[model samples]
Target: MTAPRTGDQRLAGRTALVTGGGSGLGAVLTHALADTGARVVAVGRDEAALERTAAARPGAVLARQCDVSDPDSVAQLAGSLADEHIDILVNNAGVPGPVAPLTEVEPQDWDDVFAVNVRGVYLMCRTFAPGMTARSDGDILNIASVSGKRPLAGRTPYCASKAAVLGLTTTLAAELGPQGVRVNSLSPGPVDSARMRRNFTMEAERTGVTYEEAERRFVSRALLERMVTEEEVAEAAVAMIGLTGLCAADLDLSAGMVAR
Candidate 1:
């Protein structure tokens, strides 16, 4: 008899929770972790999408509908999984702004984006950090954006939320270092996601150009001269979580688009 050869068994016997695992980068990440032999919990508000992702992976993935922005919802999720422990967590659920100047932006939009992007990440950490501390070997990866570092035009709330995530990642890494929990962030460049496409469309409408033109304009800003794919971002997240001694910092996986 021969031992089975598994690929990227780096995450074997580990459990991971990925928010926004229904579509976009989240879906790709879920598959990556599963391939690496981790049991993944796919959390998001979309039941159909979640089910599809879970079904695709069969025994390795479980679907759970969760809205990260809602403290109550997160609390319930934590309670439901009390018997289980998570070794890796990816805070990947977020939304871009409506592309308006700060003065013209509506309060509701600002609150909604914050509630999901910033507040949701905070709530998950608060609820799960203690468990990671107890385990003394856990990884928390927050999905930030390049907008978090450089101030972008017509995106006050979006930029503010991601900037806050960067600060949170740094501070949490410091606070949780002693407890053996590694907290890090990954800032992705313009990946071809549904949200990205919608934002491009909005920019095209605003600029009186076609969406294709807007996409080209976005790609022009990147040194690579191409859009970053979701798979590339997903691989980055998996590598970050697998890295050792990764505490209190963020990894800018933006493909040379943003400076350190």
Candidate 2:
């Protein structure tokens, strides 16, 4: 087989499975992967969204509905895809959880966040990693966040769950390295999305500020003085997947948010 070309065709022969691929950043990543020549399986709990993603890409993207937080669902997904070889796994399923002080946060809300952000990654890896280990050739990219390292008040569950993902990615890299499986994470700062807008709105209400002011507070933290874009995040993910030597690493796409 001809080796895949670099740039837009670097992933021509690869197959990537992306969780949370139905909408938002997940949808963007799915499109990016397909544009780069990889056959993509876009999995998430939203059937309609997943269908839309698949419809957008036609034959290049396959949509599957699976809740990453549920083991049984994930197992069924794994079983269904057993015949296909997945060269890349992107654990991008996550939840923002309740935006409230820890004291005011509900216990169940916290669990819900971890269920999708932390436990979801674990379950996906547990079910799909063995295939990679046996084949000894694959890449696993966990979508973490800058909040994992920086303190984000009123987002205890989200921050903690992302931090856990960072830890999980590092340790999994070590365990999978000898087996020729590379594991790494991508940590992006506040991306300009509907989700972040909602966060900013909540912050504004919580702090008695205007929405624009709340947004400024977040942007000011980054040296770029702006929020990252979904395209940037998706591009970085593609780059990470193509970097064969990058393992056990956490690449920061946080717009210098962690520099301080």
Candidate 3:
């Protein structure tokens, strides 16, 4: 298999399973993997969006609607994909939790955030790790956030869940590395995505600022003075999976954020 332009393209001829592939960074990662000749299985709760992602490369993609929080649905999806052994698993499915302080946040919101961010990653890893271990050559990339490392005032549950994911990635890397299966977590800053926009809107309302002003302030928080693009995160994902000798246990893809 010939590698593509980016070193991440070393994934050529492999099979990839990307959760949340219907949109945001997940969609970009799916596109990048397909570009490098990997057959991709795109999973999400939105069937139509998944179909669109599949349509981009009809022969190279299988779009499946999956609610990662629901074990039964995940089991069914796993059964359906039994014929396709995955070589790269990207646990990108996530939910933006309520932008409320810990005291104001509802219990249900916290539960839902952990269910998707932490439990979803655990479920995907459990479902796929055996196959990767048996093959003795595969990569697992979990999409975490910088907020996981550095707490955000109003995102208590999100911060907790992402921190758990970072810890999980490190533990899995240690457990799976000996089997030639690499597990890593990529922590991105505020990415320019639909979710990011929605988050900015929420911030604006909560802080009594204009959306544009909130976005500006948010962007200024990063060293680059802008939100990182989804493509950049995808690029990092590909690089983490592609380069042969580099098995980073935890990769921080933040565009120059203060490390916590």
Candidate 4:
């Protein structure tokens, strides 16, 4: 979905908790929700980054740092927010696991990736879903990736963790839908950002091509012929949050990367 050029108060009076809300797509998403009139809680482990996110709209965004993968940390966060009602949960925090063949993958790396991408979601759901059900109203948006729909060579751990996310998303939707809570996933392609710029640079060096040439080849696989924009992804996320009956559905913000 395209972002509205003008802001509106569609989500007024609602409170949204966005994990990893300090940088990259998370920062964009924080602004998107806040612009829509939702009080946004920007959650991340980086205190400074969270501070940066909250600085944009000091009144609308509240920065809170916690390790999503740790159950104890999430518990503390939940306890702190017990008096507040969270209308939406955007599980956006993630880590790009080491790129290597499955056989060469390290055990610690595998566990770490899974801990953040999979276990983190589980902990958040466990801590928050009950409260949502009790209120009989809430929505969950899992920031998955198109890579989850297919195998990603040299990124097996990342792929596997995301695939687990898809599995968890559907199952949780089934369990929570009966109680009037909705859960869904959003899958976006490679985003244009500083992190991806580094990836593109590495690709240029690896393939003996110019950075622009490597980036061109990278987007050629996508039907849209370009990587996704941050605003586009954030718009899709805001749209997902507004959905009422859509549970277990995945919103593809991949610019047709998977379709190709």
Best by TM-score: 2
Count of clashes in candidate 2: 0
Better structure of 2 and 4 per TM-score: 2
lDDT of 3 by residue, 69-116 (tens): 889988999999989989999999999999988999999989999999
lDDT of 4 by residue, 132-193 (tens): 89999899999999889876666789889999999999999999999999999999888887
Off by over 4 Å in 1: 1-7
Stretch of 10 with least lDDT, candidate 1: 2-11
* Each prediction's whole-model lDDT (CA): 0.87, 0.93, 0.88, 0.88
TM-score of each: 0.94, 0.97, 0.95, 0.93
Residue pairs whose backbone atoms clash in candidate 2 = none
Candidate 2 per-residue lDDT, tens place, 48-137, comes to: 999999999999999889999999999899888988898899999898988899999999999999999999999999988998999999
Tell me the deviation in Å of residue 31 in model 2.
0.5
Off by over 4 Å in 2: 1-10
Ranking by TM-score: 2, 3, 1, 4
**In model 3, where do residues sit more than 4 Å from their true spots?**
1-6
What does the lDDT read for residue 36 in candidate 4?
A: 89
